[model samples]
Target chain A: MLSIKNLHASVEGKEILKGINLEIKAGEVHAIMGPNGSGKSTLSQVLAGNDAFEVTSGSVTMNGENLLEKETEERARDGVFLAFQYPVEIPGVSNLQFMRTSVNAMRHHRGESEMNAAEFMKLAREVSKQVDLDPAFLKRGVNEGFSGGEKKRNEIMQALMLQPKLAILDETDSGLDIDALKVVSDGVNALRAEDRAILMVTHYQRLLDHIVPDFVHVLADGKIVKSGGRELALELEDRGYAWLGIKDDETAANSAN
Target chain B: MTTANKEVNELIKREYEHGFVTDIEVDTFEPGLSEDVITRLSEIKKEPQFMLEWRLKAYRRWLEMEEPDWAHLGYDRIDYNSVSYYSAPKRKEDMPQSLDEVDPELLKTYEKLGIPLHEHAKLAGVAVDAVFDSVSVATTFKEPLAKAGVIFCSISEAVRDYPELVQKYLGTVVPHTDNFFAGLNAAVFSDGTFVYVPKGVRCPMELSTYFRINAANTGQFERTLIIADEGSYVSYLEGCTAPMRDENQLHAAVVELVALDNAEIKYSTVQNWYPGDENGKGGIYNFVTKRAACIGKNSKVSWTQVETGSAITWKYPSCILRGEGSVGEFYSVALTHNHQQADTGTKMIHLGKNTTSTIISKGISAGKSSNVYRGLVKFGPRAEGARNFTECDSLLIGDQCGAHTFPYIESLNKSAIVEHEATTSKVSDEQMFLCRQRGIDMERAVSMIVNGFCKDVFKELPMEFAVEAGKLLEVSLEGSVG
Candidate 1:
């Protein structure tokens, strides 16, 4: 469902993602684990079409369409969703209104009529139950004054509502408590299907314990140095990333090779 | 990315949409400022002798007054001799009693302004009085408003029919010599809307005035007066858009509002005068004075504005809380882009005990534009236990633009409490990224954030005006976000 070849990206002229090559098929879940500044967040931002980062080399495609050429909204409409690490606080726009607008924009892009207010409210109510988010929260400004756990749940609720083909969870478990993590993982697990893919980016293997990955790739500096099964995350958790003995430059060179 | 670039490219080629002058015939007065022009304007309106003398007095006062240079705006000197003081659409000898009898071309002009004379066909329940150049083109929903004992008509007609009312409240809030523009407007003002809500009656519809300037080399000096009697309530809206002209056109307007015992008045404005081109060569010098007075116990008055146009705009819509327990509020969102300059805010005065006032102002500046917020809150000696709260925030889209806030608070009553807060920040790249990562594009994201920032003020606007104000912000910031 997704492919990245030699993806080299940078922000403000500083290289972040160097030669990241990865592929994920439908129904597959992948976990990319790395230390801080290992280009994990950069990878998610680049995939979501953030303009601040310049893709110096390579390409990304989703379902055989050129994702790099699309605007951020177009990319989302094409079924790519990114759960941001820190959700934005839009002070006066209610969560329901934001969700409705996003859904309508995506639906419009997909050549579908917009959902009316009644239909949208019905859908929102049903999804709110599944995500265990308070229905009252939908009427509040998007993430304004919301606690850390509420924001995470709201992000998951948005992903569940959109039902994207590919979901990128960028450290969705960072600030969540144990119960919040369980609920978020449960929401993600419910959406797993034969035609959808999930990419979980995390620092600790604890989140992987809830939403198990089919494959795990270790990213160092800006390049992926190791690819293995779920056991790879457990191995890295037991032993630090130094177990690889390969420096970041070596990994870049190796990826180039 | 492509959408942002497209908007930027569009801004690069932005042209004034309503810059053409229709070839309609007009009865025009000679250019230049003099007692003769004032006398001619008053006589043309067939005003009472007292009004004529009043205009002559204001004209003499304006002659002695110098144009205000204190506002944080820069503009070339206005050539008073090059502007026609009075230019009205040529009306028939008999006034039109119904919309059908109005001139078709005049109706077309109002239609182009989105203010058709059919109330049922209009959106958002806006009963409009369309003023083209200097004369009222059509007034809608007159029958329904008349049934409610609400008198809405052209100021010229009101002076003839309801002379007592007009004489009682004409300059009650903002006097003729309040400012240079107010004095000028009082001197040669041609025509504007007059609204009176009778005692104990709540106006059933939103009263709006759509002012358009289509005559060449003509200055539009419109004077508006709205009075809500005891136990009455009313909401009034004013919107202005001028056809583009290469030479700067002067528009000096004065608006006065009065709220009596237990009355509430809400006034909103969405000013979209023709902003100059990127080089800032020519546009409207919109100098306006708007003020409301709370004259009786427990009276309330609120002013809300969404200003997005004009090359140089200088206005301060203020409130005088004279009654005990009266309240005054001002909410403003002023945006300037592409060489526009606006110096606007409000003034609140507390005279009686336990009066309160609140002011919230948000300024957005982009593309070398300058926006300033200057406000004053004053408490008199008898204003015991009076309170005031003010918050002013500015968002700069680019480094080239500027935003400033100047607030003055004075209290002579020892028991009064006043607090003010202000902040200045740019639409940081990080905020944009947060929105983009959620699949929102840059321009929409910027607009969303900006709307959120000004939501407080937007909510204070009438429903229709709120929607128009939102769209205006989008259009004003078309190429602003990078």
Candidate 2:
């Protein structure tokens, strides 16, 4: 469903993603684990068309369509969803309103009719229940004064609403607790569809223990140094980057020893 | 990103939609201001002699008064002599006796302004009094209004037919000697709406006035007086959509509202005057004074205004809570794009025991515009247990614009409590990215954020006007996204 060839991206003229390549077909889930500054988040941002990172020498395609040529919103409408590491706070804009507008925009792009407020509300309420988010929070400002777990659930709620073809989760599990992790995992497992793909970028195997990936790729220094199945995550958690000849902190290696 | 910002800014430079001149012959006073000019204007309207004397008194007082320079505004001193004080669409006979007798051209102009005068068909529950350059053309549903013991007519008609009521209420809230703009408006004011709801009577329909300044080189000085008697209720709307083109920039107007015992008055204004060209060459200078007096115990008055146009706007819609346990509320959303400057807020004066007031103001500045909120909350010596709550928020769209807040609080009563909260925020790029990434366009995203910022004030507007205000904000925010 998604393809990246020699993805070289940078921020502020500093190279972040250096000549990286990845491919995932429909109904597949891929996990990219990396140390700090290893371009895990940058990959998600660049694929979602965030302009802050310039794609200097890369070509990305979604369903055989050139994705790099589209704007951020256009890419979103084309079914590329990026769950931001830190979801932004838009004060005064109700979550329901923001979601409704997004849903309508995507529906319009797909040549489908726009859903009325009542119909959309019904769907949103059901989805919020699935995510364990209070329906009352839907009426509040988008991520305004929301707790870390609530913001994560809100981003997951949006992913569920959009039903994107390729969902990119950028450290969505960073601030979630055990209970929140379970709820978030349940929501993601529900999105395991026959025609959709998931790319979760995380720093630990804790998230993989719930929503286990079909394939795991350890990204070090912007390139995939190792690729394997779900057990690769456990190995990384056990041995850390030092086992792969990459130096991070001594804590993970010392603990492994 | 640069290209996107360019497109956004281009949309922000939207042409003034109602800048086309209405081609109609008008009976106009030569460009000047004097006692002779006031007399001639009064005589033209067939005003009572006492009314003329009142205007003369105001004129003399205006001569002694120097224009106040305290407001945070920048504009060249107005050339009063260069502006024609009066310009009415010429009629072959006396002012139209009914809607049928009104000129078709004038009606067309009002229709273009979205206030149909030929019939009360479009606006089913709202009765509108359409005011052209310097006089009222037609007031719809006058008979129905009169049936309810509610007198809704042009101020000129009220002066002639209901002189006692007009004499009693005019300038009672905002006295002619109150300030520089009020004095000038009292002396040279040509025409405005007048409402008098009798005791125990609730106005049947929404009363409204649409003020349009069509003629070139003529200043539209409007005087509006509303009096709600004991146990009465009324909601009045003014200045819908665009105020059309005004070659003559000065628009000094006064509006006074009075609510008696147990009476309630709600006033809403959607002011879309011309803000001039992109270069800020020619636009209307809107200097208006609007105040309401809660004169009797338990009276309530609320002012909700959405001001989006004007080159330089100096307005302060205030309330004097003189009645015991009286209440006053003000909700305003003032947006200035391009070179527009608006320094508008409200004054809440607590004089009665247990009186309370709430003020919420939202200011949005874009394209190098300057928007300021200057509000005053005062409590008198006898105002025991009186309280005031105020919130002023400013949103800047682009880097070029600016927003400011000037809040003054004075309390003589030790028992009084006043709370003030102010915030200054920008239409940040992160906010924009969040919205755009959700598949909304730039315009829709900007408007959404801005509308959320102004949700508090917009809720106070009438239902239909609330919708219009949202669209107006969307249209006004073009090019501010950068």
Candidate 3:
């Protein structure tokens, strides 16, 4: 359902994603693991249509529609979701308000009537429970003064509420405690379905234990250098990236190039 | 470069919707101001002898006073001599005794401005005094208001009928010699609304007045007076719009409100005068003076204004808390875009013991516009244990715009407590991108954020007016993305 061909991306005159190719089918979950500066976050941003990353060469398509041609919001309307590693704080804009606007925008794009206030409130409450967030927090400014763990859970809640076709979780487990990690993973596991796909990008192998992936690819520099099964994450965790012939950031970035 | 951004660009190019000139013959004075002109205006209104004397005295003071330049504004020098002092629709030999006989064209102009004269639309039940150009055309819901012992009519009519009320409170709150614009307004003020709620009475409904400027080269000087007697309460609303023109039209208005013993008055205004073109060609110079006096113990007065238009605006709605335990509050949201400039705030004077005041101001500047918040709070010697809290926030949408704040506080009582807080913020790219990525478009995102920024002030507005204010801000900030 998703395809990326020779995705070469750059930012501010520096190439980040160099000659990367990947294809994922429906009902599949893929994990891309790498050390620092392995272009893991760059891959997620380029897929989500961050304009700062210039896609010099290659194309991305979702269900035969060129995802690269759509604007960021249009991409979102087309069912692409990105869980930011650092959630933005929009003071004065309540989280509930933002969620309602987003939900209505998607509904409009799908030729559906707006969700009524009561119906929206019900859906919001149900989603908040799934992420273990108190509904009262929804009335506060979006992520304003939120804890590190709460921000990650809020991002997951947004993904769950939108119910996108392809979800990209970028460093969702970085700043989470053990309890928050379990709660967030449970929400993600609940969202897994036959017609949806999940792309998990992480540096540590810890998250793979919670939401196991069908495919694991090791990204070095800007290319996917290794593709394997769940066992690959366990092996990397035991021996580290050096065991896979990957040195520290200095050598890994050059050798992969 | 998204569809939302493109739509915002188109909205920015939209022409002024309320700029159409009404086709009606008018009785307009020649372009100039003199003692003779003031005398003629008083005679046309058929004012009492004292009214004429007041106008003449104000005109003399105006001549001696130079235009003040203390405000944070920049514009071409106003050619006062080139502006017509009065322009009113020529009344028929027999004026309309009811709404039906009113000129259809004049009624249509009000209709086009989303104001209904039939009294059955959404704004029904609220008494409205429609002032066109320099004279009031019609007053609606007068009978209902009158049956409730409420005196609601045009200032001219009030002078003719309830002379005592008008004479007692005309310039009491904002005296004729208050400032440059106030003096000019007092000198040649043509027409406005007069509202009086009798003692021990709460007004049955909201009282509103709509001011429209259609005549070219004419200056609109309106005088609005409202009096809430002892133990009474009233909410008064004022709104204005002007037709588009190539030359800046002058709108100098004075509003005075009085709240007697244990009385409460709430005054709200939504001012949307023309803000000229994108490059700032022609608009309205809106210099208005509004003041309320708490004259009796425990009397309360609040001023709420949403200012979103005008090429240059200089206004300060103030309250004088003279009575013991009286309360004063000011809530404002001022937005300036596309070369528009606004310098507006409030003044609160605590002259009695235990008096309190609160101020919340929100200023949004977009495009190349400039917005400033200038406020003052004073505590007199007898204002023992008085308190004041002031909060001001400024939001900038683009790099070319500017925001400034000037707050002055003076306290003579050692027991008085005053607090002030101010903040400045920009619409960052991260916030914009986050909203866009969530499927909400940029234009909606900008407006939503701005509305959130102004939520405090908007809540103070009446329901209908709050909705209108939200829409006005959205239109004003279109294409202001940086």
* Candidate that scores best on TM-score: 2
Task: Write model 2 residue lDDT over B1-482, tens digit each, in one string.
Answer: 43344444553556666666678888988999899999999999899999999999999999899998888889888888898999999897768887888888888887777788776454788999998889999999988999999999999999999999988888888888999889999999999999999999999999999998887888899999999999999999997333444343778889999999999999999998888766676788999999999999999999999999889899999999999999999999999988889999999999999999999999998887899999999999999999999999998776677899999999999999999899998777677777878898887898999999999999999899999899888877765654
**Per-candidate chain B TM:** 0.96, 0.97, 0.96
Question: In candidate 3 chain B, what residue range of length 10 has the lowest lDDT sum?
Answer: B2-11
| Residue B400 accuracy (lDDT) in model 1 | 72
Off by over 4 Å in 2: A250-257, B1-11, B120-122, B240-248
Clashing pairs in 3: none
Q: Candidate 1 — which pairs collide?
A: B19-B244
Shift in Å, residue B347, candidate 2: 0.8
Ranked by lDDT from best down, the candidates are 3, 2, 1
How good is model 1 by TM-score?
0.94
**Runs with alpha carbons beyond 4 Å of true place in candidate 1:** A246-257, B1-20, B118-126, B438-441
Share of native interface contacts recovered by each model: 0.48, 0.66, 0.59
The order by descending TM-score is 2, 3, 1
Candidate with the larger TM-score of 1 and 3: 3
TM-score, cand. 2 vs. native: 0.96
- Model 3: CAPRI class: medium
Worst 10 residues of 2 chain A by lDDT: A248-257
Q: Report model 3's TM-score to 2 decimal places.
A: 0.95
Native-referenced Cα lDDT, model 3: 0.90
Clashing pairs in 2: B8-B479, B9-B479, B12-B478
Scoring only the A-chain of each prediction against the true A-chain gives TM-scores of 0.94, 0.97, 0.96
